[model samples]
Target: MRYGMAIDTKKCVGCSDCVVACQTENNVPHGYSRDWIAETVEGTYPDLAMEIRSERCNHCDNTPCVRTCPTGASHVTEGGIVKVTHEECIGCGACIESCPYDARYFHPDGYVDKCTFCDHRVKNGQDPACVSVCPTHCMYFGDLDDPNSEVSKKVATRKTKVLAPEAGTKPQIFYLI
Candidate 1:
């Protein structure tokens, strides 16, 4: 089944709890983020509004990173999750350069790094780290194919957007923009 995440930006409180949880759960390398938040402030002084986005691997359907990886170490799972194999990677940094979302990282261990949607946890019947620990309950995770699922329900009922639609990546992560 295809799985993805949909995050409600309105409910996000700019808390870093999700970030710290993902870092610990995935064993993501230090000095770099597997998941991070970005913000854009708009309008005049009195009408200021902050747009906060929690971003990671876009897990594009037409992933440039997957196509650019010489060793085939960076690829997408059937569930629409992008993963980089630390051991198989040559650390050529090609994927890092090719990723439009700035998702990939070249670790100090001489291998490529990126988010895997906490695959280990998912395989163990757990939600992705970020989803499980989001303090505001803004992040939702479920099978996109299941119409009755929470994620699908949100998609059907709300307005959402994916990052970099012009890139033709068809990202799995959606935002309530």
Candidate 2:
């Protein structure tokens, strides 16, 4: 099963609840974040359009991070969740440099870290911390391979876009506009 997420940009309020929840649930360092809110405003004055989205690792099907890792630390797990095995990571930063989304970060403990879609939680049939704590309920996560899954349905039925699609990573996260 390929896991994925569909985030409704229109529904997101840029409150950053998802970012805080990801940090708290993942025990990420105080200065670092696994996910963040990105806002883009276009047009002029009253005609301006704003889009706010929670961004993180795309868990790409064609992962440059996994390919660039010298130590094989960066890898895709079941459900296409890209993860770094801290013990195997050599703090080389290859994966960080390869990620088009700028999702990977060098940890204080000398390892690379990023979002996992909260794989531990997903394995237990729970949503990712970011998805679960979104006050607007704009985030939907599930197996993308399952046509009936919420994430799959949302992507199929909505005008959605993936980050850096030209990079051809085949990113799993969809931003529903």
Judging by lDDT against the true structure, name the best candidate. Answer: 2
Error of 2 at 145 (Å): 0.7
List runs of model 2 lying over 4 Å from the truth: none
**Candidate 2 residue-wise lDDT, 83-119, digit = tens:** 9999999998888888888999999999999999999
For residue 52, model 1's alpha carbon misses the true position, in angstroms, by 1.3
lDDT (10s digit) by residue, model 1, range 70-161: 99998878688888877789988888888889987777788988888888888887898899988889999888999999999998899999
| Candidate 1 off by > 4 Å | none
Cα lDDT for residue 87, candidate 1: 75
Q: How many residue pairs clash in each candidate?
A: 0, 0
lDDT value, candidate 1, whole model: 0.86
Error of 1 at 45 (Å): 2.8
Query: Residue 129 lDDT in model 1?
Result: 89
Rate residue 155 of model 1 by lDDT. 83
Best candidate (score: TM-score): 2
